[model samples]
Target: MSLLISFSHLISRTFLLDFLYLFSVQIAQQVKLNKEFFSLDPATGLDGKIYGLPLYGGTDALFYNPKLFEEAGLDPNKPPKTWAELQEYAKKLTKPEKGQYGMGIYGKTVHAVRIMHYMSNAGANGDILRLNRKKNNSWDILVNSPASLKAWQYLRKFVDDKSIPPNTVELTYPDLISLFAQGKVAMLTTGPWGIATIKAANPNIEFRVALHPTPDGKPPKLRTAPLITVISKRSKNPNEAYTFLKYLTIQIGAEMAGKGYGVLTQTAANTPQVKNNPMMKVFADQQKYAYFSAQELLLAEWLKCKDQAWGPAWEGMLMGSVSPKEAVNQAAKRIKEILGDKGNLIYPVK
Candidate 1:
């Protein structure tokens, strides 16, 4: 009877311990990051609990490798103001035989992503895959404009000079970021994801993130890919999601910019931390200058012609590919093909 009592007491204690541990874990999981706000999110269609907010925390300013610029006798504080200047700086930064590159950018990729974010600022419109696909595909506001052609022509100088690695042809997003972080490339235009990783990988590197240089003596009309928090249609706790998202985005989550995590597209400018930090300030000020890329059925098709026709077309024309008129015409012709593929014919030349 004494042994039986002792054994029973041991079992009871063990069971209690196990139950407590499991309960603790459940609490931890439930409280993960933004989980607490779900109760307030708009599931019951309650306006008191809900508000409208545009997308936020989607991008950051990009910069050049400052140490490399210094070595090349360039001032890191002053980046190139225009495409002509950037190309020139790249030429100075290039040191090929030892496997150094001047600029690390998307070179010859499909889906036309680079021009979508950075190209439009030069008064371009590079979103060719799905124009007006989102609320802000303003990327193609000026796809048919002369400035659009000039932006492309400027890009070819890097190609013309072979400033990037030959493998740039096969480079993807990860490849480019990795190469840039290693100081293999002199300049790169990117946002927080690259900043977050690069800081982790090469924290001490002489680099600073800044606005992507514009070709026309100003910043490009800014547009960045935004990371959004949306309530899932199928979520059992959609109200939970809205509650969580509102608190995350509007309250606690807005702190991401301070921690160098999220971009805070909506209140970035107003945030004390964002306003105070010089690095974060660039983005906030640059925000005023940004507008999204083209948006419409078949906008992407027109963007390609703007890109392909401009760079080689305009550069070659300036360097001699065909006359500007001929080049523009050729670009228009190519756009027709891309449009036709999507069953959304843009050029009526057919």
Candidate 2:
């Protein structure tokens, strides 16, 4: 009886292992996935395996009110193409007496990720953290690099010019979305999720989407956060779990995109339902340039560093309590401490 019990346990464990292996292989062979949405397991490093499927993903782009542009004496059809132009447009759209600001800068809780979007676009190599191809594929922290500093300095211009809301430091993305919906802010950089939120808030607001502006009018690299689905290794029926996953990711994902609930990550899943919506179209177009940030790739280390180090440092810089260089250095120090020999630090030589 004891031998039979032990054998039964062994057989169950073996079945679980086999199911997991087959599930991974089936996903690779059967599913059509966006390669950019494919993520590496930070806990295990890159094992060259597919463990999850992204149902939908979100990416940031410039959202401007066309009416505000017209009111500011700027061409409604021609949005800013570069950071300099964005600054200029913000100055024009800002109307202090009317309680209106040209731009919305997210500075409150969880603002580190949003700010990273700007840093990513301004990165010299199009990323804040890059894998060094020549250095055993080690990650390089470039948050304190010159391009990043320049991005910070550019943001400071809004504070100095009073183009951002007076309560900017007290507001997060949702707050900014509310402000934008109320027509208190002229422009914002946010994800597609903002569309439904804005429309639900105010159906009368006229807005358009554009690709995020870059430092030199080059192609922008924005941060993407993908909503992925994975099956548990302990599932009783792996095949049934996979079937459900397909249903949710493909059929339901497309329905969500069509209804303006969210954006789908699967290209083939993008039927007329996705393409028909003007706002959804822009987001779909922006996916080609969207990527996951290093902080996102390594969630454990990032959670430790973001609020404790990066958030405070970033807020300090935005509020003029610290310089851009000081903020970057401060955050980088804590990040390195947390990361600790995980990868090589590649700060530009002074």
lDDT on C-alpha atoms for all candidate structures: 0.52, 0.69
TM-score per candidate, in order? 0.63, 0.82
Taking every candidate in turn, the Cα RMSD to the unseen true structure, in Å, is 14.7, 7.5
Reference-based TM-score, model 2: 0.82
For model 1, residues 1-350, the per-residue Cα lDDT tens digits are 00001111222242532322222112122334322221222211111222222234444466778889898999988888777787888888899876789887654443344554544654433333233323332222233345545555566567779886766655767787778878898887766556667777777776776776765667656554333333433446645655565565666655776666544445545578777776667766565555432221113333345456434444344344465445544554555554454323232321
How far is 151's C-alpha from truth in model 1 (Å)? 2.1
What is the RMSD, in Å, between candidate 1 and the native fold over all Cα?
14.7
Off by over 4 Å in 1: 1-55, 108-111, 124-145, 229-245, 270-273, 294-350
